[model samples]
Target: MVSGTVLLLLTVLSVCGKAAAERKLVYVTVLFRHGDRSPVKAYPTDPYQENDWPQGFGQLSQEGMRQHFDLGQFLRNRYKGFLNESYDRHEISVRSTDYDRTLMSAEANLAGLYPPSGRQVFNPNLPWQPIPVHTVPQSEERLLSFPLGDCPRYKQLMNETEHTEEFLNVTKTYKDIIDLVRNKTGLNKTNVESVWSVYDTLFCESRHNMSAPDWVTPELMEKLRILKDFGFRVMFGVYKQQDKSRLQGGMLLGEIVKNLSTMADAESKKQLKFMMLSAHDTTVAALQASLNVFNGRQPPYASCQIFELYKDDNGSASVSMFYRNNSKADAYQLQLPGCALDCPLEDFVKITKLSISDDRDKECQLPSEGRDKEVIISLAVSGCLLIFLIALLLGVICWQKEPVSSRGYHHVINREVGEES
Candidate 1:
């Protein structure tokens, strides 16, 4: 009886170990928008200008700092077991766009994420310690910034999208509001794209309890908000969204999928546990759009998109996503289109491959029509050159066949006779 009991106990322990090994969280990547900030810019005729802001335009506010700090603490609680109690630089990485608001947000978040403790405390008066946040200059930033201007094909796509039925319908529906905004804001133009600025300026002003002009009413504000949301959709969706994503957000998505693949490899020496990205709402929206999961609403301040890689017992890996747009509640799980809530890493990569461009520069070349025109011109030029070459060859052939051209032969003989004399 004792021997039998020992065998059963050993079998139970083996099963439990296998269970623990299944679906182990191996890596996490969190991409978050910056906290609240002043509007990037105000309309020309708006009452508030750059001077109206405390720290000038586009700067992070105190509220923004608090929001990010709280977010970091939330992260701490959520990843309590996964993350170390102390900061480990080798285990995690933080990168942000080269903007004041994003940079400051990263700093504030790190303060809450890795508050100096016990022996590591440098300043006794403060609860924070310096943590490194990496960034690239805005001109060189492609991973986190959306709608990069370097792609001519993306620009052509936008122009094509503007002429689509859906785009035209939205434009026709908002013509009245667009005109009103143009008049009120004294802007040269107020198309769907430019109208977002009007909404952003008013939204920021309202958030801070600043009184708006008489022309701005609650009804108008709601309409503007809708238009602003539509603008974002137009930028990333509504037409050829997947193709657009391949050029824009897919770049970031590609990097993320690559990281997940690396982490999934048990033999990989990469020991990274977390990667934190601080960027703008556009970045968040762009990424979601690349995945075909954007909610079509402006992501709130400090909104985060989480990607977790889990290793299963069979040496396979899977990915799960969550969105933390609401601070009061837990992040909601997101299901990838054509995938379950917990998607296999292979499926995730495969489904997303269509969105990722193999060669963005090559793909961003002029559209087929433009390339066709270039080909036509090139063919025309080649034809002309070919005709000239053929004519020259015929001329030489005729000259050689004309009994050695008596006049040319006599001239050559006269020159040789003069040299002999």
Candidate 2:
């Protein structure tokens, strides 16, 4: 009897496992960096200038287009039946930063994702059809850009980060290398924050097989590479990573989580299936930092961070993340720090709460500096007093300048008497 009962329980457990495996994909959000591009800017002594590039500085190259196209094809294969075979504006949304390269990359990606078919085809000669990739002005781009310039709190955090023990140690250890870059690259400033620019320009030049300066030896290149990676960590990780993420990457992560949570509702399941965000490498790093799973290396060109939401037969939803940094390799599955690879939505949200900010503006406001607040108050009081005295002096001067009017009857009588005489 006991054996029969045990066999029945085993059969029930096998059925439950199968049901879990059949969870339906409810939604997906993908954030990817632009493909290869010309250097953003070159140092004063650099060999390659802006004019050397085909489209000048910061424009995406032909290889970049290919990278994004391949990414789109990969997405199409992954979401074969989940998404429509043709482009549907209602089902998917694409947002990109307001930069030429990112905008172009998004368009190229769309071409591979939704090749025109049947009525969707506008012209036979071209397989591509125009798809909207929306963007806001660069100044207002908080959704996809990291190390946001407008967040004063984030700036304060960065400033404090520079003073931390880890930061000081890094600076002290790499002092010689930093000095070499400053002197050789003709960069006015060379610190942990700015050293990455030199690395970036050199890395891009090397990729294009352009000759680098004699100073950039292989050993030097390796050191610059390490510093560049460290620069990324300093930007989004290193000290108080969660707080930094809340102010930088957490902003984007919060929106993505909200969207996923909304789609988890059965009523909203069909409303939207896919969301594509085209942004920078820093943006990807920030989000990964917030998730506490960043690999601490620079995200490569066309790198993609993907979030997939699935609902099991039991009506519970889970979120899964993947990072595709290399086109030649499979995307790495990222597990939320305290959860499984497929984390329950509730647990995911709870674990990520510390990184999300409800009021970004409030959080960005740094506490008043030690003595600066007193100085500001003193200056403000003095200025107010100065203004008050100036107004009083002006009032007196106006009164003194006015001519006193003679009494009407006395003035008229005196004038008449003088005329008669």
Using TM-score as the measure, the top candidate is: 1
Looking at candidate 1, the ten consecutive residues that score lowest on lDDT are 405-414
Question: For model 2, what is the C-alpha lDDT against the true structure?
Answer: 0.91
Top candidate by lDDT: 1
lDDT of 2 by residue, 188-274 (tens): 889988898999999888888999888889998898889999999999989889989889899998999899889998677366899
* List of clashing residue pairs for candidate 1: none
Give the root-mean-square deviation of each candidate in angstroms.
6.4, 8.3
Backbone clashes under 3 angstroms, per model: 0, 0
Model 1 stretches with alpha carbons more than 4 Å out: 1-21, 368-421
Cα lDDT, model 1, residue 362? 91
lDDT of each: 0.92, 0.91
lDDT of 1 by residue, 1-421 (tens): 9999999999999998887667789899999999989999988888889999999999999989999999999999989999998898889999999999999999999988998898879889999889899999999999999988999899999999999998898889989999999998899988987798889989999889999999999999998989899889989999999999999999999999999999998789987999999999999999999999999998999999999999877898999999999877899999999998999999999999999999999989986877799999999999999999999999998887787556363534357557532
Give me the runs in candidate 2 sitting further than 4 Å from their true place: 1-17, 369-421
